[model samples]
Target: MPYVEVLAPQVPNQRKAALAKSVTDGLMTAFGVTADTVTLYFLPISPDDYAHAGEFEPQGAGQRILLKVHAFRRTEAERRAAAIALTRGVCSAYGVPGDDVAVYFLDRDRSEVAHDSKLASD
Candidate 1:
């Protein structure tokens, strides 16, 4: 399974559903996971809560989206491909510039993740 967390301040509510679908599809394709095995979470933040370069973001800070992906360990090449897929999916879904979307991947062992009161390794 793979978990994707998206934090953004500029994403419009009307498009969130589409964005989620895009993210799920990208993850499934990139990691060869089933749709039900991929989890997508969106956390919307206010400008007052987000900052860059040690300054609070202004009203027009631009369309910025941050993605954090957690999954099983993989080769560097695989991780790189997944990141590209995620970035393209987000940018295409939200109509944001590619540079405004960033994707970070974290590889974890099965023992490090838990679901439904049980660890993945269990």
Candidate 2:
């Protein structure tokens, strides 16, 4: 299972739907995983709640998205592909520059994950 958490500024529900679909498609292409195995959670942060360089509202600070991907370890190439996909999804959905998006891969083992109260390794 690959769980993706997206942290970004609030947007409309339609944009969220588009982002989810795009990201799921990318994950499938990059890791050869099925759509059912990919889960996405969006955490919207208000502009007032986000600060950069000690500035609550940084001028000219374009939209920034932080993506945390939790999944089993994969090759570096796979990770890179996933990152590209994620960035593309964010930029396309949010209309932000690619440079503003960041993807962080959090590698996990089967034993470290659970589904429906059952351990993945079981």
- Quote each prediction's TM-score: 0.84, 0.92
CA error at residue 4 for candidate 1, angstroms: 1.0
Evaluate all candidate structures by whole-model CA lDDT and list the values in order: 0.79, 0.90
Worst 10 residues of 1 by lDDT: 55-64
* lDDT score, candidate 2: 0.90
lDDT of 2 at 16: 94
What does the lDDT come to for candidate 1? 0.79
lDDT score for residue 119 of model 2: 88
Q: 1-122, model 2: which lDDT tens digit per residue?
A: 79999999888999999999999999999999999999999998776566666666644365568999999999999999999999999999999989889999999999999989998889
User: Model 2 off-target regions past 4 Å?
Assistant: 58-60
